[model samples]
Target chain A: MKSKTLVIAVREYLAAVKTKGFLVGLILMPLLMGGGVLVQSFTKGLEDPTPRTIAVLDRTPGETLWAALDTAAVKQNSGTQVLSVPKPRYTLKHIETPTDAAGLDKTRLDLSDRVRRGEVTAVVEIGPNALKPRPTTTPGTEPSEDTAEDSVYFSTNRPALLEVRDFVSRTIQTPVLAARLGQSRETIEAVSKSSRDVLASRGLARKTDTGVSFEPRSNEAATLLLPVAMVVVMLMVVLVGASPLTTNIIEEKQLRIAEVLVGSVTPFTLMLGKLLGGVATSLTLGAIYLGGAAVAARQLEVLDMLSVGLVIWFIVFTIVASMMYGALFVVAGAAATNVKEAQALMTPMMLVVVMPMFLIGPLMNEPHGTIGLAGTFFPLTAPLVTMMRLTTPPPISWWQPVAALLSSGLMTVALVWLAGRVFRAGFLLVGRPAKFRELIGWILKG
Target chain B: MDDAIAIEGVRKVFGDFVAVENLSLRVPAGKLCGFIGPNGSGKTTTLRLIMRIYAPDAGTVRVLGDSRHGPADDRVGYLPEERMLYKSMRVGEVLTYLSRLKGYKPNRIEIDQWLERLALPGVARRRVQTLSKGQTQKIQLIAVLIAKPKLVLLDEPFSGLDPVNSNVMRDAILELKNNGTTVLFSTHDMASAEELCDRIVMIYKGNKVMDGTINEIRAGHNTDTLRVRLANLASNFDNLPGVACAIAEGDHHELQLTPTADAQAILRELQQRGPVELFEIARPSLHDLFVRTVHEGAA
Candidate 1:
């Protein structure tokens, strides 16, 4: 760097780092994130613990289904609590089946009123043929919807109570199967126990010189959380570093300080200086957050899950992304005469910066899929998408990341060059900001 | 002496607006020249062209003997018409930063010295936003001269200053000229231009209307006016022979003469009308010349 540019960079860096807002933001981001997790954990134990009473109208002739449901509820209620918080208990209330359709409608209305008044948590109508075995369907074909004869109608106003639904569905399976087979429940239990060892999932075995060795259980942190976390951190750092450039530049122009600085150095030099300064500021912030995370991970004995190679890649991507976005932000600042105008100009640029976040889910689902590969090659999304793909299962080829870095680096250079031209043309314009077309003209003409 | 700045046939345009056209000028080294013009008369544009802030569409601008088409080197300093400084920065820091940009690494003591010289002592520690308007203007001047450039361009350096501050600034400018630095400033203060400029260049509508020493410019205009003090306040020179118009000055009347009119004949006519205590032919002032040139261009 030229000495003049270096001087400017030093000033710009200090101007940002010395502010109270920077300090507050640096500390607040992690606090808020950590606070959210803490709130979730604390709120988990606070869920309602009152036992739920489910009204059952068993229309089967044997009347054995209610007895089975009562026994199942007792078993579930006796299960151990988690985190010292009791699980929701269930109590079954048997209701006699109506003799006619009119009688059934009156019974249904009474049950609905009871459910609304919280006297009963839900109503379960077990159809007369519920225990009859379903006809077999062909392989790869979906079964038809259950008819009223074999359907178990579980109705509740609180449809979001998924745990209650899961428990009821799981407890009735053995009894329903036993009735159709004309066997005792013990026999069905015995068959289920025998089939329990029929299936298991394991990682692919590696062939060693001694023998084939099975891999250890997958680490969720290393495989799933690490890459997503890294990409999020990269996004945060890049934004924290580059987004402020627009505000700073607009402030300088509005204050009329840009012309004085422009008088001393070339516009490109001034812009490059500010960009480097912003990068330095962002790196400082990232280092603090990452350092804290590292210490915490070490305390949790999960430090090994943090890959050094991934960290290096994080820095490389952060620099490339910051420069690219920083130049665009600088262009926005130069093309506008005030903060409002700059914000208007920056909306599309900001959208492009954040576009990768929306694609993270698809990229994570298929790390080597089309969307992932496309994001890796597209410079704007490469930093985020490529980072996420690196940590997902079924690792991508090595050449993808290398190519992504190269392409993004080249794009950064081109953007900086374009930003320099717009900056030179727009720095002295104190009137209304130039339109997008005018900025394009400046870039091309320069 | 060598020319400090030389512009040959400069033409600058903004969209369809021609800001400067077919203009040429030269200022010798160590001379203080005043660029005088009305608002929107292209004076600031001309100064910007010299500083290379705006490159001419078709012209050559050589500064400090270098003809390269780029920003002026560190040997030249410019204080723009709009006084601007980093409001959040300490005055001393701003000065040091600007000085460094000119390739001069000024220390705190040197910066303090410049502040002291500008009559802005004890302000080096204050943020620019905290300073008053006049103080900020003085600090801006200090920023321009801190590097001691061979040539300095000041656009409306005294625009917002009070009489005392203006005097301080005028003294500082004179000091620069005395120290062999070329100074070119643009202003509408004709009296100051007449008082301080070693040479004057007047522009109207993107063209040079007049350029010369004060005496030379005055000599170029015909001495076709007479100033007289008569005993009677109501004495009118309107009906006098060879007089075009009469304007009242305090305790006197100035009679404008036609091309065929003689100053002696006008004085004689005034004497016949009343007891004339004083009578003399006077050259037009710079203010008059500026107004006349603008009107002529408009016509």
Candidate 2:
């Protein structure tokens, strides 16, 4: 036969999971987190896509100009390729103009008409001496003048015009340099690769028994955001999981169900069942988020950098924290007559639960800081703050986590004991919620 | 085990307020006992002590052979004054869940049968919040009795029920008694107690005022009042011999005679004066005795 506590736990779990709020929270929380990650990744390396059409009057007197335009398009498209963003393909229109100064000026004057007619997003004019080196310049010497030589640009869209100007500049410069150096493409690539110095940056890794494993360092701060965010998520689950206990207890009291329940089971049994149910709820939510995070981490190829031990600690800490907070809420609920009174009684406990969220930054920055140690050793904040510290770069002593876990467990048990006493005393009470003095009186009398 | 419950000098106090004081009562096994008292008269406090919802500060209480406090027995079932079950849970689910907490297996068939018996078969899958007041009361009553407990304690069970629903609840209590379950319900409604209780216990200001069978309590009170109905006559019947006072009661007149007065003489004189349609000496009712006893105890 199952114990009565298990029955109550199962009933409480079923009651909560059957609600529409549960289903919505279960599905939407992960989707929201995934959406955040996707938004960051998409916005990282690419600018917003705006359509552009370029009219290039390349007066450089050769059919090879088409080849230069193709190369520049490929180079411009390659900028977005590394980030996996879709390239905003631009239409390249070649303008037929005489190589004389008068004809060039006439074409430049017509650029605004073409833009007004919507024939192109922008017009770029190239002079006949656009790629011709001046007699004062030699190979390997810095070109004092730009190759596009006083090119007149016209556009209605500013962003599109900037992109077109960049494409046109690169289209003229690469070919002019190659012609001036008289070098083949293979030789230029080889020389550039040999002379380039790539400076790679990495974050300091936690020193394990074996060796240090460094995490890839990027200018993006999101790499450090994941662990701290996990702490916040776990804290959020703890708070969410424990909220129902207060309302449920006070509701049962106001509805008089607690009278019937107390007649059939011990107050301790009822409290134990409720605490177990809360832990189960928190764990269920944690599992959904953890699974979603795992899928996301794997997709982002950061799965290897994630610590399995930290996740395990997250599960343990969430259960302990939820039980501790759930017990306190139950006690507060039993002391009150209604939801409003219950919330009033729970104000102090709510503050305690919120303390760790504020300390997240300090703990993430210095896992062994004084604030981190205080949070880890203090029974109220230990489970959350300690779990956060374990995921940060600075590795804590093994004894710290073990000590935090043991202390949190003891504190949870003590709180449950106190809750049972409060419940027995106030389950049948009505009219007004107990004052702090009365609650203390109950505990001391017990 | 002749008595399902036995309390002796049970005293409970909240802060400085004595909710129940030196209150002792007993309910015979397989008997329906009405715990009668007016509002705020220690009725709820005493019932809670019986169910172990509140531990007595100064005495002993034994229910179903258990003396330990705090819901230590599975043989006791309680229906509190407030009838709030899980409002969102299905009717069957709530019943089954409550029964399981009482250490019984979930019985769908039994639950469905109960729903049908209560004329609520269609509500088996409905939420309790959607039910009418009477319907919710019936379901809560069922939850109390579903565990087949030996001792059932109901507080203010008939407070807000209509005549029809009140009859249903009255019959349900009697049915539990027939099943050999000890049923003790607290109520301020005296008529129901007079009609339904085999034994009644009355308390006032946390003090026991009366306890015994309803007939025994009524017989103990002075029964000198006479109820008479007659045709039109002189309105000076108040001046009749041996009649101390006459008060009109609906279609009849209740004449309270002095202790030294002769009731036979008064009836004869009234008959000689006018045509008397009805006249009878009335016994003291539970309501009358309750009012008299509580007043006397207060004095």
Best by lDDT: 1
| Per-residue lDDT over B69-157 for candidate 2, one digit per residue giving the tens place of the 0 to 100 score | 85557788888887678888889888988888788775788998888887788788998889999999999889888888898989999
Worst ten-residue run, lDDT, model 1 chain B?
Answer: B262-271
Q: Which candidate comes out best when scored by TM-score?
A: 1
Q: Between which residue pairs do clashes occur in model 2?
A: none
Q: What lDDT does candidate 2 reach at residue B259?
A: 85
After the best TM-score superposition of candidate 2, give how far the Cα of residue B174 lies from its true spot, in angstroms. Answer: 1.4
Identify the runs in model 2 with alpha carbons over 4 angstroms from their true place. A37-199, A202-223, A304-308, A393-395, B233-235, B297-299
Q: How close to the true structure is residue A381 of candidate 2, measured as C-alpha lDDT?
A: 91
Look at candidate 1 and give me any clashing residue pairs: none
Candidate 1, residues B82-128, lDDT tens digits: the string is 85788889998988888888888888888888888878889889999
In terms of docking quality, model 2 is medium
Interface RMSD of each: 1.4, 1.6
lDDT of 2 by residue, A174-264 (tens): 5655554676656766776777877656666868788987655541254576767777788767866787898888878777778777777
The alpha-carbon interface RMSD of model 2 comes to: 1.6
**Residue A369 deviation, candidate 1, in Å?**
4.2
